[model samples]
Target: MDETSPNIEADAPPALDPAQQSLSEALRVSFGILKIVMVVLLMAYAFSGTFSVGSNEVALRLRFGNYVGSPGQRVLERGTYLAAPFPIEQIVKVDTRPSTLLLEDEFWFETTKNDSGLTRSQLQFQKAGPLHPLRDGSLITGDSNIVHAKWALTWRITDPVAYLTNIGSKEVAQELVTLTSQQGIVHSIARLTADEILRGIVNREQMLGLIQQRLDDMRTGITIDQVTLDKVSAPLRVMRSFDAVTSAESDRARRIVAAQQERARILGETAGEASEPLLDLVNAYSQATELEDPAHAQEIETLIDTALLELKINDSVIGGDVARVMNKAQTYRTQITEQIATEAQSFSQLLPQYQLNPRLVMTKLWEDAREQILTGDVETFYTVPGQLELQFNRDPEIQKERQKEQLRSQKKAQEDAESNR
Candidate 1:
């Protein structure tokens, strides 16, 4: 009885069979399941969201609709990171990539007239609260013609949050751009004529920037890249009048250019005419010198040229040059005489062109030299019969000898005629 009672140990609860072991394992599994549940509760955190930021993107985290923190200039390059979800924290993704968008504004166009005499149209005159187009509006021209214009604007969002928050959405930004641009263009068009706008690229750009300024004042974070005229279509009713004005401008430009060319031609002609008298004087002076006119010669021409050149010609040099030239002329005359006497031997080859004998050729040349040496002016042509008669009287001996020969020839002719009789 003592040994059996020792077998029941106080510290040991039980010695189970296979059924007990199976029951213990089932309880163990239950405890492990409970531990897994606690771990899941600890791991699944609430109020967290994911951030997918690209290489050029940044995420601005907000808490309770207020700015909590924002990524710096460099983007949070890794994509899809978890963050405190919305309501506790909200993440706004911003694109830093270069981008652009274009928007066109709605504005008033041409109108129809009513009995009230005001410009009106069914589309523009119809009232739709704030959405009605304007009528009787005008567009400024470069050349003062009333033009109709519409614009296309291209812009970029430089700051995404600022753009989204301030401008509201891409749709709202577009609407503001269109409206602001229309207002600016219309106001500027009032200051100019339609023709001015048509011919100007730079002017249109400046006006577009003015429109952008209107939106920027509202703190819209959009940067206008450019503004362009989409079209300058005109009202069909005023086509002829505008065409007439453009034609007049073209005519004015043509006439102005023609007048300038004519003026240049006249100036050139005047310069040419101004030099003609000097050329004539030089030619006349050359002919006189060739004839050995005593008052006009190459020395006098040289003196005149030196004076015109603003150079000095002293009396000693001028007188010495003239005397030396006269002496040289005489020596030249002797040599020419010797040559002519030698050439007179070739009568058959030389005399036929002149219808003269070799002796007559020499005699004619001698007379020409005599006229040249004594003449006060150029040339030795006879003009009237009386002057030729006077010239013959200067040689009395040759005349008397010719008269005696005429008498002898006449007597001899009479004797021969008597023999024939």
Candidate 2:
């Protein structure tokens, strides 16, 4: 049986060689390893499409140069997404965050990089030559005045697909936005006066709106968040003149405010809260007078008088100087009326008494008048009936009393003056 087995083995391809067997085994293991490596490579190739979208960014997947998925699903927001690998598909990420673009010297006078540190005077001294129209950038105002400005623009990609399709990249979008904003600024500043621009009267909101409109018209898929005028000024040659004009305008505005304040104060002191209505009446009356309408003027005057009367009668109404004057005048009128009536009554009674006895009444009246004259603060001279010569020199005591009276009058005048003040 053993001899037959050997013969059969010898016949079976003369038995496989050890080296060949080992070589065959190694070939099998290598093939299995190669298959596993191929599977891993395929998995790697498939997962290579995985991408992360940032919180502030949107992603668009394009397959064969065309966007994938429906219109609404095309833009991928903050998350992980997978698409076919390159050549078959492309992942386009768009930053949706607000991007700032500072446009400096675009509308400014021609200046080199070294001129940045120069002051206005230094720059003016260095560039003393006439402006180069081609080199210099400027905006013409409504007043036919030239001005320079620096601007800052904030923008964002609102429509990712549109942005990716139309503008393509942030850099290209920024360039387009900047160019459009410049055009918008030119159009906007042209409508404003030089003084308005230099004095910060630029309508940035309007400028931004116009720029956004322009972007929309161009289908740029970019929206302007803000347009800021960082700096604006007239040409260096006329800057001082513009400054002077600006200063004069500010002074004029200040004077107008001061005048308004003074008017308010005066009105408040004249009639308190009623000052506004009183002023309205006064203004209407003045206007009527200027128009030569006497009837209207008279009507306004009557209304003013009525308002004044009501203010005086109603104690609840806060009265100012006008009310105080009216009260004083009314009080004086009452006092004078009472005094005149009492004097008239006294005169009437005396007339009847005088009619009853003329001589007696006359003597009595003379005595009463003499007594009144003696009681008054007057210098009285007395004479004896028989004495022909009277002493011309006054008494020392009387001179002393007169001096004392003069001192008292001076002191009383001083006190009255102080009280009035």
Candidate 3:
């Protein structure tokens, strides 16, 4: 083991005896010498602290259980290497490549959170899983129900040493994961109702999140790619009711969606009503711009007038013979105009007469018109210009009828808006 051992050379080649020596013999001796030299060189090479690493592989040099070198230094890139002698150091090869593991656990019992919220309640009715016992998973659902669950955990070695320290070994990791994954899945399952597990959607991402959180709390350096819902079966007693509730839920969802759509329709009408004034304001602004372009004033005013007329028509609740109401308004306006025109000339001649006894004629007319406009005679006195007074009659039935008509109109206006959109 000393350095001097390599320095010592083998004995000089023995002298060839002339009688036994021949061409082949001499040559053989020479070849043997060369072989010995080659061997010596190989031995020296072997002790030079060299190793090999494949293209997809890495290596670590350890001296007395402590890391001595990085993954590869004197190691071959993708070929053979003659490592240092055993007493000096050793090499450990690790395949830094992608790999997969299919692990599973069968948990017959479930650990659940207890009502005290301090300790969890284990499902004594359920049986313990075969892999390992996961002690800290308990959940209660919206509906009262409990069930045991187990799971499979597939993981990879992200950090070899960490994995070693955390999960111990791949086999150990699988075992721990079998127990923990089962526990986690059961915990989640127990927390949910049969409907949530059955009809409810268990998102893969959420499941993974739950799994990863528990693993992190335990400091297990692992990542969950997915958590598949393998099966969801309800307990016997409420199974039938659960199935019925599913149908009712679907019907309820449909009703909700329909209601939402109706609400949207109503909202569209409400928004339209609010926007109408904006439209009018824009038109009015355009009309006010008449000072900027006198030539366009008539056009702007025409647009405003058209918009007002349209709005008025829209406000009138026109549908099926709505033209009649519009015609009535127009006719009433025309009659008022005609009556005023005729009365204007008469009023000029009557101004002086009215100045003297204006009340006399109008009082007489009002008295006579009251009889026609009213019912169930009630009389009234009036101060007149040409007479002592004029009598007036009022009727309660007519007044009540008018009041009823007003109330009906008010209710009709407030009942519901006409759909504008």
Candidate 4:
């Protein structure tokens, strides 16, 4: 309580031993060094919590083992951020760029090895399959045909959170992608028959679109960029058979198309040939129907008959059967044409005679009819218009009776003459 001087000497009355003072100083230094070392370690530990995400990457943050931020907002942008160290919080960097999966042996059906006791060099030169079906990965088409199909697909992560949460790991996601793509290719191939695929009738573009669609439907949080079809063919052992069948089908189709085209051409040509003559015949017949004058109608009738003959001639000329059928039709047409021409000429000659002398024409017509009717062993009689009608008693029974009576009288006179002698 007295002014500070002697009391301080009382509190510090016991002085340190020399060795003890050295030991105390040394201990003081050690404590200071330990404090400095601890400060440095703390600074280093704090710095270790800082991490950065590149522009092409997204960082997913989690606190206490739970994702921090909204479902979509949990992804960190390209910048530096301090996260609580290790067990307290975590950061996962996800690359959001495009990636590709090569599908070859994984998806493509392997060709059968030539186990037919062939030499190794021979098998290598000509790879003949039918080797091992169970080991081969092939797609059986709708037509029950098998084919090898290989394809490659490119994809990218679009929704990082979904990708991380749903897939959980990049490796698993990649494996899923490859498996899904294989399924897509196999499914698309199943719908197409082997012939359709080989002949290009299967729409390749549509198949690729279906692959992407399937991937999208899986909600794999990845965008399909492209699908490349590397190979689509039959196995080595069946290549020759496949080629032959394809060739035959192509030839059949080609022949069918050619026949159809030929038929069309023949029909067109026949129509062309028949048009003018048939049209003239139609006009002539129509004009004759409207005509009141006898001579003019007859002339038109003659022209129509000639036009019909000409039309027959033209139709026979155009057809696919250019040789045998055409010739037969043409010959028949010529015969018909000649007959029509003859009939037309006969009418032409008769028309003027009929117009000039009508009575004479009637008389001649009657005489002609009489001559035709009485041509073979037959009798005929004529009666003048002003004269009485003549009668001929030509009954067979009366003639026979008269002849018998005359013969009996002659026999009786002969008997009387004999008796008088």
Candidate 5:
């Protein structure tokens, strides 16, 4: 041991203070927390690019101000999607739900609101002054008549890319739609009369098609759901006159409809569904006859006769007044034929008797005739061998009785005819 040469223990480094050690440990923990916070922030930034599209919404993704993906894939449907956040990628959402817009004053008269929240036009007999070109709006009809109308438009975006690129916003799209619709209305109304416009005789579908065509040409990418004419009329000053005309027109239409229905009913009752064809055939036959073409007339008459014969043979084929008349005619013909046949048979049977006893046969026939005459519906009076110049004046009471009996007989005959039919 060389104690006097050197001391190796004395050359060792000194122990750190407790405070510095504690500070060092704290610094390490702070760095670990900061790293964790930075990771959380980065995750948040990444997830911020996630978006959810609703059922009625369409989304488009653009990278560096230019559209991304293929044409079909450019538009995103209802789902969740992710993209690079912020300046690297941008998302545009378009609502595809149907929206309605009412253009009330575009072609409507200037109106003032009443105390009850109703417009002046809604009130009865509210007069309006001369048109103010700056304030009031109106449309000129084909007849150069002034008319007013209010319209409602329902639309929705069909193509997201076109709508976003062309229209860009709802405000701008609404303006375009309004302008286009106004132009369409002006053009359509200019081609129609005021009466036609008020009566709804104007072709609304064609007008809407024209408007849609215009939109298509402009590539608006909007589909029209519907276009409704809410109100239409002349100016308030002539409202009463217009209303009178409208009411008259409505009455005329109703009367026309009723007359048509009555005509149909009469024709149906006359010959069922065959009435029209039968009438046409009869008219053709008449025309042919008027032309003095006997051959054509005869041909048409034969066809008509064949049709009638078929109808008579099969009553069920046509159930109408014509069928009933035919049935009655056939019954009368059958009765007359049967009567003639019976008389002929009886005469044949009585020929030998009459030849043997002619006087007796004559007396018997006279008695039969007298009996039939007495049993008939006439009032019989027997005056014995009178050339007495008797005045023949009908008794009122007897005439009344006879008339009643005749009416009863006619009613019975009609009932029997109907039953047979």
Candidate 6:
């Protein structure tokens, strides 16, 4: 046992037999193949995590089952993207395009035998009748009227990150959108009456706006495009009766409008014809006051009669207003006749005295006229017995000339009579 021998033994390689050498060479080859296999598997695992986003789709990348990007940076646009292998990072592709959901509401009827509900086919099999409260799904209007309604909602994903994170998937998001939209529809229908919906008075677009506002409040990244109604009507059983009532109402309205138009036309024609006569009648009444003579009363009465006659003729076109005018005019005629009779009585009393003494009656009439004219502090001057005479008449010579003319007229008349003889 020498130190040199021990050192040489530790440093020198051991001698192998042929069988041992062959086993050693096989082990090296096996390790190389195993390493190559592991590299291939790892490369396959990393490649397996890659995904593609379409033009209409957005890819959301998640690391360790959690989202990896910020609000704005979370979404991957239309391109191929690579992430860490599965279990480290995951990708979910969501379609951001518009989608539609159709919702249908059915009407149910009740019979004596079955009060639960009647399907459409069952309804067809039986006779049509009123719907049952238990079977039918309807909106209870403000006026307590019930109506069946069906509509569809169209929506699209606007914020992919919010949509993906909040709603999980497109299918789930659609379901949520439809649910909220239906709620909005029910809310809107509750505010309207059956007549408003049936008559097209309520704005359908406003309903869509309400549904959209609901969706926005939910923040499910769903944008409602439209809300379209498919049906709005009363129950099928009473539809015919409803139509009949509607038809009757429309007919009544039309008849009322036609009657109003006819009335306006008739009144317009009568007014046009009677306007001038009515004006003349008013003027005649005014002139009667100014004339101050009972002799012209008959003329004024005749004018009123003529005006009433014209009104009666114009009013004859429409039997209604004409009868009224005729009755009023008859009353007016009676009043006029009575006034004329009173005036005639006064004239009759004066006529007898006037015939008995012309000069005395004339002088009395002149004195009465002076008394009526000299009212309210008026002065009367009569020059008598050597008092200073007040002669206001400067044209006394004109009166003398009038007397001379009268004599000339008598002379001319005598000359004409002699010539004729």
Q: What is the lDDT of candidate 5?
A: 0.85
RMSD of each: 19.9, 5.7, 17.7, 26.0, 3.8, 23.0
Candidate 4, position 164, lDDT: 77
Report clashes for each candidate as comma-separated counts. Answer: 17, 0, 4, 2, 0, 0
TM-score of 1: 0.47
Question: Comparing 1 and 5 by lDDT, which wins?
Answer: 5
Greater-lDDT candidate between 2 and 6: 2
Off by over 4 Å in 1: 3-50, 55-58, 70-88, 95-146, 200-202, 247-362, 366-421
lDDT of each: 0.60, 0.83, 0.55, 0.72, 0.85, 0.72
Question: Residue by residue across 1-421, what tens digits does model 5's lDDT show?
Answer: 8769777778877778999999999999999999999999999999889999999899999999999999988999999999999879999999999999898987887766552566555544444567888878899999999988888989899998999888899999988988888888889889999988887677788779878888889998998878888888787778789988889988999999999999989887788777778888889999999999999999999988887767732333555788787777888999999999999998998899999999999899999988998784567655668575665666678788889999999999889656644
Give candidate 2 regions above 4 Å deviation: 1-48, 82-88, 112-118, 203-206, 288-298, 312-318, 338-421
lDDT of 6 by residue, 1-421 (tens): 6655558766889899999999999999999999999999988987987788899888888898788878778888999988988778978888878798876643223334573376654654464655666766666776887777767777888887767767877678877877787777777878987888766565667778887787677677778888777767676666677778889989999999999888667655444345444545567777877888566767777766754555443343223344355655688999999999998997788899989988998898889888898764344556778758576854566667778989999999677544432
**Highest lDDT scorer:** 5
Off by over 4 Å in 5: 1-11, 115-124, 213-219, 312-316, 349-364, 367-408, 417-421
Residue 219 alpha-carbon offset, candidate 6, angstroms: 1.8
**Which window of ten consecutive residues has the lowest lDDT sum in model 2?**
312-321
Q: Indicate which candidate wins on TM-score.
A: 5
Question: Candidates 3 and 4: which is better by TM-score?
Answer: 4
**Can you tell me which runs of candidate 4 are displaced by over 4 Å?**
1-12, 107-131, 199-218, 244-421
| Better candidate by lDDT, 2 or 5 | 5
Per-model TM-score versus the true fold? 0.47, 0.74, 0.44, 0.51, 0.83, 0.51
**Candidate 1's residue-wise lDDT over 329-409, tens digit each?**
667989999989777765456568457566787887789878778675333345665534444324566567778989999
Model 6 Cα displacement at 341 (Å)?
60
The digit string of per-residue lDDT tens for model 3 on 80-149 reads 6665566667766645454443322142333234522432222222322332336432334446654333
